[model samples]
Target: MTTLDSGERRRGSDTRPLITELIDEGTVESIAQEAWISLVGEDEVLVPLPGGPATDPVSSWVDVVGPWTGSVVLTTGRRTAEELTRALLREHSPAVLEEEDVADAFGEIANVVGGNVKAALPGPSGLSLPDVGSAPALRNPADLCRVELQWRGEPVSISVQGALPPLPAPR
Candidate 1:
């Protein structure tokens, strides 16, 4: 954020609450579970156990702008993403899934999860359209709320991270 005074731009102090203060790992896990059940299938479950790290990660995210600003990101393996698309699409899934198909389905899941996350946050906040690609880099570790889980034994991670870097230490 920027402060304007006397024709000069000054950096504003970041007083926003850290994501960890506003939310927690359990909350993020619960949110993801609910989204999975509703969108993936009523019986679909997200186990709290952490699986091995993703080999080829693909991420989908929606930017949240408000009293706390950042992106709600979902990251998993490309193969897992394809499997999720097939599961989400079910009978309607193509015999051969296209790249766009995976992106669309994966992005939709992020949208649902991100929307709920935005609502849980101090609002009057705006949610951006879901984007599929690499995950956003962490700006401040202290400002992150992250959860790791398994979906069909595949590793999946959800991160609610701050957009801005940490504030300078008071001198």
Candidate 2:
């Protein structure tokens, strides 16, 4: 949020929690839960891969925006991600966010989750922006803060990363 002539953060200074909680109540739980379940359901059977090539590993996300470097490391098979996308767009009418739109959706999801998560924290920022992508781990793994969020008992891990240089040394 930029500042006006007075040099104050234009968005506001008070009541971020209220704003985020309202959003969570309105959207996050339902959208995330449905999306997760559609991708990986106990009732649905998928051939277990032997952790080889041709077998698509689960997709994960890393949040690298603002002061909040939180990541959501999700293990979603290619099949699961595709199925989730189709089901989510069809049922929720989110207008079919394309792969090109991953950035947009990533930011949106991060913002939503951050807000809700912030509501739970006493001191919170105004919805950290989100970044998402398919990060394949090579010899050296990515170092990121990991948190698991479960919807109705299904666990999805979220990772939060620090700025490579720690937010410019806090001004």
RMSD of each: 5.3, 11.5
Which residue runs of candidate 2 sit more than 4 Å off their true CA positions? 1-69, 72-75, 91-98, 101-111, 126-128, 135-156, 161-171
TM-score of 2: 0.39
lDDT of 2: 0.40
RMSD of candidate 2 to the true fold? 11.5
Which has the greatest lDDT?
1
Error of 1 at 110 (Å): 0.6
Candidate 1 displacement at residue 167 in angstroms: 0.8
| lDDT of predicted model 1 | 0.91
